[model samples]
Target: MSVQEWSADAATEIVRAHSGVRGALLPVLHALQERFGHLGPEATRLVAKELNLSRADVHGVVTFYSDFRTAPPGRTVIAVCRGEACQSCGSRELERHAQHSLGIGFGETTADGSVTLDQVFCLGNCALSPAVQIDGRLVGRVDADLFDRLVSDAAAR
Candidate 1:
């Protein structure tokens, strides 16, 4: 979606409110991402202009942060943790299963656009290894069948 379609009032308010704060780029970008799903090129330009920074500077910040999304995410996000703890518990195998099942690899959406897959380092639930997050909810000990069920449930949502 075009950034012009975003809430200009909200964007203005966000920039105005945080313009004076040091290191405000991340928070501002996060707020915009939360509101609009991702930070498109237009939004980045607007932000840079409002903050008296260069577009390259804005792009640099966005690219530097993994949490900052540059495109719209699908309705459901299927993220699998790739950290050592999760990998030890078979996250790599699960990843392959998910990719094959969804017909998409990391940072991609399915053909029907029902879900977007991503690779995360850690879900912060190491004890519950082989972690998978469906729409922000942490799931653990996920096998192929179980992961398939989780994907189906998330798509249903």
Candidate 2:
């Protein structure tokens, strides 16, 4: 089935599944994103109506959390750590190299939808300083070369 059809059906099922729980908004949003890869307008509207919230309220919740995506992500996600520790260890240079190589800034996906670049404050690997998470696997001490390799590996996958 197409993503749109799946999104509509999944949104309805998720709203119904979580409607009875207290503070169901977050869970419902997470479920929708999990099933559909993102929360578009249709899912947001459905959640708002089911939970007695305004579209703005639902949209606010979705936007407030960095984990949520309003649109589908690329085939791979690259999250770079931007914490002070990582910054001190040359994360800035790595970030620049990544942007140049991918031709997209943070929070943007490649035109071909192969990769998405994202920034995270920390990956809890400060000891390694320049840390990056590619598809949820943490790699530390990432230099420009390492970053390139990681991106290449993700694309290959």
Candidate 3:
């Protein structure tokens, strides 16, 4: 998803729009991240104030949700499925190739900012083991060469 820079005015607008909802915190956080690519400190603080919650309260929620990111992600995110099906089909090797070649572990973006490598439990494509998701595009039967090519494609873009 495309994201705009964090603006207090813009964040305030987003926050205020959702503050009235029941259990508004999650929705508010999602909207903020959708706009800014992350829930940075200033935005978090703004939300805490608008929701009449403590910064610690908001921060705990942010950090607790795996879906929320506190910092900007790389342009492309590559997720390898390590589900039982995937693991039985050489996903371990594929996972190693991703980590070694990318030189970053799960949840870390490449130094060049072209990609972020992540390990997920499953993509639910067990029929085709060793599944991968590149920027939300599901791919099956991936190998080291294919992974490299995909990364190159993302970098070229």
Who wins the lDDT comparison? 3
Residue-level lDDT of model 1, residues 7-64, one tens digit each, is 7777888788886789898889987887788899988988999988999999999999
* Poorest lDDT segment (10 consecutive residues) of candidate 1: 1-10
Error of 2 at 35 (Å): 1.0
TM-score of 2: 0.91
Q: Give the runs in model 2 whose Cα sits over 4 Å from its true position.
A: 1-5
Between candidates 1 and 2, which one is better according to lDDT? 2
C-alpha TM-scores of all predictions: 0.92, 0.91, 0.93
Across residues 1-157, which tens digit of lDDT does each residue of candidate 3 receive?
Answer: 4789888998899888885699999999999998898888998799999999999999999999887888889999899998999989899999999999999999999887888888889998999889999988999999999999999998888
Best by TM-score: 3
Residue 91 of model 3, lDDT score: 93
Model 2, range 97-134, lDDT digits (tens) per residue? 88999999999999999999999999999999899999
Clashes of 2: 0
